[model samples]
Target: MTQARLRVYILSLFLIATGIAVSTFSAFSLAPLTFQVMGVYWLFSLLYYHLRINSRRGSTSVEYGINYNVSLILFTGPFGLYLFEAVYRLIGYLYKKKTKTDEPGEGVQTFYNVGSFVIQGTAAYYVYQWLIPWFEGNLVAFWVLLFLLVTVTAVVSDLFLLGVFSLLGDIRTRADVAAFLKERSILDMAKTAFSNGLLLLFLEQRNWTAIIGLFVLNYLVSQSYLVKAQSAQDKHERNKYEHMAYTDFLTGLHNRAYMELKMKELEKTKEAIGIVVADIDKFKSINDTYNHSVGDRVIQHFAAALKAKAGTDDILARSGGEEFTMFLRGRSFESCLALVEELRQQIESDAVEAEFQDQTSRIPYTASFGLYFFTEQEEVPIEKGYIYADQLLLESKQLGRNRITVSPGQQHESSLSTS
Candidate 1:
């Protein structure tokens, strides 16, 4: 448990102790429900905070994440004290997803929400249960008015909270932590929960059956959210694994291993393949002058631009530093060569205005490519496919830095459809 939760637990214990002490000397019978709700809040709040850390991972939608956690806010007990903890967790989560850093005071609204809970819940507790009899001529009328007031308070507070939170519609699940965390100006989760919790006290106290129902409902819904999150994370992890193995991380392009993997996949399918290997022109000179960041940008910008020129079916992976390759999925040797030539021209002509968030100057960069096309007359293994592409890239570099070379293999049987 975090320090904050410990504080909440200690405070709750104090309240329970106070209530018990008060009941010992008076006719007032303390509601066991308050203690039960407080205990539940402590437990769930821990879980909610832990999940908040795990869910801020790559590409998870912020709206979906918030919605995913909403069931907890709805069914939780005690004027939604736990709901406020969820909000604090959410604040941290929003910060990580958007601004990419957890800046100080990023979740001030969350703390304020907790404060609101203390004021409102404490006030309502004293007013409805203690002060009502003093204001009424008849005790029955006092009880009725007290119930009505708490009910209205709960209803109005929930409506106002929903109204206020609706303004967070613009938030996206991007890496902008500071801005997202700071955007909320109104009621936070804690206050909302505390205010809403008033209604639960009027409703019949939940027994084992009700507890079971709440558990099952929350579990099913929360588990569904977890499953979706897990699925998205699984997909991302697979993609990331593939990228790590096959991509040049600095440039975000295919690495040497990627070329080998795709080649093997193609050879297994017995499809015609085009291998175009690319190299940055004057890459060493750029590295020498502007250092690695600019050099890194040159590679990244080139890869991004080249990737823009290719079809979705095409394979473009950075094979090594300043060297890259492309695999055209279902094209003939001749057509694939032609495609590489087009790509080579695009790389030469394209000027990347590589901007630095830290600097004002822009740098220009370019690269060359070699093309090799092959068919299934001979079985091509991963190693052979990669060596062939490497040779072609070397050939292109020897001819000139900014160029493409084609290695024509057996043309595969082409499919035709005429209606």
Candidate 2:
């Protein structure tokens, strides 16, 4: 590991050790009422253990048990609080398989989860214990201030621990850290904190009816989170599958199906358009000499060159093996030749290679272009343009390859030397 990673691991170890020590110390010095409060806390913790609002992107989660945890820290010490939280998480680790299934290294993640919660639990304990005794007359104001202070401490502690753990993973910058927090929601934090404070208030008044109401309210929030997360995930999956259906998996370009859709859309427009069909010359020779892998690399290289030459509005697509097509909008027959010649020159000068047994050799290749241009006045079908381009492309291959053959009796021999 590098120095930074070493430091992160060291910090993790330190948090774990500190959490254990504080929990042990607090256990030895627990008040007589601590156990009674802890028993009730455990009941709520167990009930809310599975009620976590998992991130839509599946990065982190927010549990509805925050109010329960905060209340526990205020009544009992951090020792019993951390111990209960750890047990709850351990149960989750064993039975809960949703997030952990996709995530590797569950053992280390368990340590971080317990350690971070313990650290935050201890901080909340200190802040609440130190401040609550200071207020004299107005107990309502005192409770509000104490609740705000403890919640703020919890939020900051949570962010710090999460930021540290994120650094240990793939998150590398302040912007990433901020985005992480923003995506999770600061409003959720405030809402949970307020709920916990209300629970504490009701507990002081021995209002069992209000406590039950809070339970229902918190459960509803958790349900809403689950519904939102699942809906977002479903939408994301739908979009992903749609993209896959229309994309060329080999070269990461548009597939023929998508190109046909674009052609149909362009057919309705009255603007002039040019269709060019280009095929790699002697592609089978490379596949025969080397392997299919090397041929794939050559195709990917040519696709990148093609993308570079095409405009943002131009539609480029892979039309099966060794063949590609482009639809250029608002371009005449002459403009089509200029674009093809520049792209052909780029392909000629492109140095693409594939490695075999630590040896690399350039996969030199060329392509022949056949283009057809149509004007707004012309009622020529798009299918005719494709047929003519393919026919002219075959003619170029027959009569000395690596040349441009345009419709309307226009043929231009490439100035660039053939590969």
Candidate 3:
């Protein structure tokens, strides 16, 4: 085994042994009522297992199981708590195993979870018992003590789990630790404590019906909220992935895939559109002269300038390395030609400042443009318009670069030079 896995196993074994010793020696009362409560809690936990909400980091999930476990620890002590945890966690481990849904090191994780629960529960039980004498006959002090007990339980549980993760090399830096703690909801912890406090109150009054009814009502409300939360989370994830797919990482412009999709959509409408294919002149020389980093800055600089000239209704994309495509909708052919010419002039004037080695260098660059103006009267494909524009762009390059070659309509072409 790897050293990290070995260390995790050793720790798990140590915790398991220590937990067993503590449970065996701990003084806990297990009445018939305790068994009844345990059975009901287990049943509800099993029913609601799939409904749990995972933390933002997905390291842990939130469930009312903790609230029930807290009540068990207080009501029947560490022994009862251990019994409930052991059986519940074992069933959970087996279910994951059977379904082939267990993550790597699932066995170690199960042991760790059981041991951590027992250790935390046993510590909480002793602390509560120790404080009971001081808070006797004082209702407010007792409530405060109970809340403190919950806090103690949470702190011990988090510390134990974090220590294990550290050993497993999951948390190597202060930022990782911060992220771990950040994903844990303080409000969820407060809710767990409050629920446990209510459960304890109900248990003390021997109101079994109230306990069941309150838990059921809380479960229903939580389920509704969880559904909405899960939906929003799914939507946010979808949008995030879509953005990654469609956006160019270098220039932050729409990528070729998005441009093609837009083209298909526009093709259906058969709208009069202007397509422009632009290429940064001598981009290879820019990278060779400075570095790829400077080249990237140049590309970004060019994209920003092009985006500035594009209308809100127009679509612009980085179709290839040092190549861009623009779709200008709702514009006359003359206006489209004028826009491209203006953009070509702007690019010629602008310079990209880049630091190379220890010196600052201002790099002057220019781009060639190929514009195809498509009218509604033409019986041609949008894809063919892009091809024609690309051909015109090559012709512009051949004509000495820094020029806009325009295909007004059909096969008729004209070249405008800025030599």
Candidate 4:
């Protein structure tokens, strides 16, 4: 392991040892009621473990078992809470091992969680004990104190996690700290505190039925929220993957696959369309002269220029390296020719900046284009038009690069009807 990982393991061990020492040295006693509460808490913890709701940000999660844990702290004090955490966390570790669900460093994580929970829970219990005398008679004050206790517990846990993350080099700057804090939801904290407050109130009244009913309702609500959140997460992942699949990694333009799909969709429509195939003039020479990186920048620059002039209904794609295609819809042959000519002129004037060996240079370049425009009355197949466009692009290059070649030359335009 690296030195950083070794240090983290050492820290985890130190905290675990500290927790065990404190729990052992402090006063401890057990009663029938303690056993009953421990049994119920274990059942709830196991259930929640299987149904944990992951937060939208970071590695934090929401589980109703937290309310029960707070209740345990209130009823049985530090010693009891520590005992429960030690056994429960060990069982969790073993279960993960058996199911082969444990990730790397899971053992260390389990120990760290046990130590942190003991420290946070024990501190909260002591604070509650110390402060109860000041608000013993006032129910409102007591409820507020419980809320504050929950807040303190949360703060302590956050601090512990932050410290560990800093040591792990996951957080290194002010911005990192700010982002970490941003991921923590104030509303979720409020909900946890409110639930803990209710649990403490029900415990004070010795209302077992109310406590059971509250937990049941909380579980159902949490499950419903989990389902909705999971559905939304799945949809987001699907869309992200779909976008990646259809996009060119270098230019961020639609790939050939997307262009093919668009063509198939347009084949069913009667729209007047223009198919254009364009290629960077001497792109291979550019790469050989500078480097592939400069060539990539040139391609990106060209794609951006085309994207800038494209209409909302127009389709532009990077069909392959140094080559692109466009589908201009609802345009007459003359309009399509004008647009292609304008694009050719713009590309000829534009230069891409390149850096090499601590030197910057503006690399001037040009592209050749071939456009084939057809009205709906002509009933030309899009596939055939694309082939013709590609052939014309080659013709432009052979006739001397950096120009636009179009079908039905200007001289023959009057012979054919326009869209």
lDDT of each: 0.54, 0.72, 0.80, 0.77
Model 2: per-residue Cα lDDT over 1-419, one tens digit each: 54367356646754774656574664544554556455666666667665554433234333333456676565555666566666766776776565655354454556666666666666766776677666535767665665565566557555765665465554667886677666545565667667777776776676768877887777777778877988998999999999999999999999999998888888788677778899999999989988888899999998988898889889999987989999887676678779899988777777688985579988788888888776777677776777888888887788677777776565554563444
Candidate 1, poorest ten consecutive residues by summed lDDT: 60-69
Best-matching candidate per lDDT: 3
lDDT for predicted candidate 2 compared with the true structure: 0.72
Q: 316-415, model 3: which lDDT tens digit per residue?
A: 9999999999999999887888888888888888898888998888999999999898878768899998999999999889989999887644333234
lDDT of 4 by residue, 159-190 (tens): 87677666656677889888877766767777
List candidate 1 segments past 4 Å from native: 1-116, 120-247, 354-366, 408-419
- Candidate 4 Cα RMSD after full superposition onto the native fold (Å): 4.4
325-410: candidate 1 lDDT, tens digit per residue = 77777776767766666665666556666545566556655555665565566565645766786786676567656665556543
Candidate 3 whole-model C-alpha lDDT, 0 to 1:
0.80
Candidate number that wins on lDDT, 1 or 2: 2
Q: How high a TM-score does candidate 1 get?
A: 0.54
Measured with C-alpha atoms, the lDDT of residue 378 in candidate 1 is 54
Models ranked on TM-score: 4, 3, 2, 1
